[model samples]
Target: MATVILLRHGRTEANASGTLAGRTAGVHLDDLGRTQATRAGDRLAVVPLAELVSSPLERCKETARVVAARQARHDSVRPRVHSDKGLTECDYGEWQGRKLRELARSALWKTVQTNPSAATFPGGESLPQMQARAVDAVRRRDAAVGSAHGSDAVWLAVSHGDVIKSVIADALGMHLDLFQRIQVDPASISVIRYTDARPYVLATNSHEGDLSWLAPKHRRKRTRSRADQDAPVGGGAGPGTPA
Candidate 1:
């Protein structure tokens, strides 16, 4: 199947202020967030993105536009950014817009930190529910892109930190409680490729490094082999090497 690059939206006032922005409206990226998004766009400029999907939230939309704009300067096709509600930030409900420090003091906070699978936001959804929707959205979109653009196609998804983390956790077969262990910094990029057998996490929370290797290359016709569904015995020559 096609590969998907998960991009967390850049920093925001809430992030700098240590608040939970959640699904709050009108929350946009701060100045540093814009620069961060721009840098991420620059890194991805060499790759041809088959699709650019983003949360409808302002911050994510802003970041997605920057990435799509960069692709426009290089690729003949200007990638259109599509909004997906499924990729939106978690519904923190009453916790929305609250300072993280204050929330940290609540008893539920302990449950959230230790057993997110059982934690539920007051008036909102559970961690499992959020993961279910997010994983479903990513898998559905990945399948669509693969069918439309072929296995070599690469795409992007700009979303919130928790949303991206949940997706990554699902890709790694990790339990929801362990998801908090994963760190998704602002504008960080993570890569995942799904196959009939399983999903491969190629990268995580990557802030720097040459991503041009992700650029899709034409594949020569060949018979399918076990390597197609399994990792190479030794890490396999790195990307760009022939099988």
Candidate 2:
């Protein structure tokens, strides 16, 4: 088995503003978003990463660059950055630029909320379609990684919130309908250790801000290493959280 870490890109203007980015071009990371991504990179830098990859989208690319640099194996990991479109965010189609609340009021959006598993936005893809694409991207990447190297290789993949969640859900053998429970925040970390048998979650929602519950001590001290604090809990190398 291998280990895979799925990182969600940091927030964007569209994300902070609550707009549906939906495959928009040039929608780069905002200032706070960049800092957040950088901090996440700092957090991940201390860990040993075998490989790193990312979605082709600008946000994810930028985020991955920060993380790869932090890992100090940028050169080693750069060549592995496969620009897979399958990891792209959900295509909001015509509603790409619309606000979430505005879209929520639309009849189609309502349908989506009511039946996200089956609803498809006009001129866009459905949840199942997105899940399928995500599974393909994730599985193919892992298979390639396994084929290229032996077991014990740990890889990091930076992608969109929904994309990472879909991939994790697939790894868990959960239905697309269950994705709602898997919350991926900006620059959040989700881990799956692939063993000879199956993949398993090492951590999820490993982001800053409100993840204190995952590590109450990290929240209290705010200075102690998460690794020192949470290692006993997760039973892993350390708190795979971003430093």
Best by lDDT: 1
Residue pairs clashing, model 1: none
Q: lDDT tens string, model 2, 1-243? A: 356778898889999999889788898899988998888876776555556777788999999888877767533443345677778888867888889988877887755654568778788888789888887877777766655554445678888877777778777888777777788999888877655456667688787533222222222212223333232554655434454
Q: Write the per-residue lDDT of candidate 1 for residues 5-47, one digit (tens) a residue.
A: 9999999998999999999989999999999999999999999
Candidate 2 collision pairs:
1-194, 1-195, 43-242, 43-243
The global C-alpha lDDT for each of the candidates, from Candidate 1 onward, is 0.90, 0.72
The numbered model that scores best in TM-score is: 1
Q: What is the TM-score of each candidate against the true structure?
A: 0.96, 0.80
Q: What shift in Å separates residue 21 of candidate 2 from its native position after superposition? A: 0.6
Clashes of 2: 4
Task: Mark the 10 consecutive residues where model 2 has the least summed lDDT.
Answer: 212-221
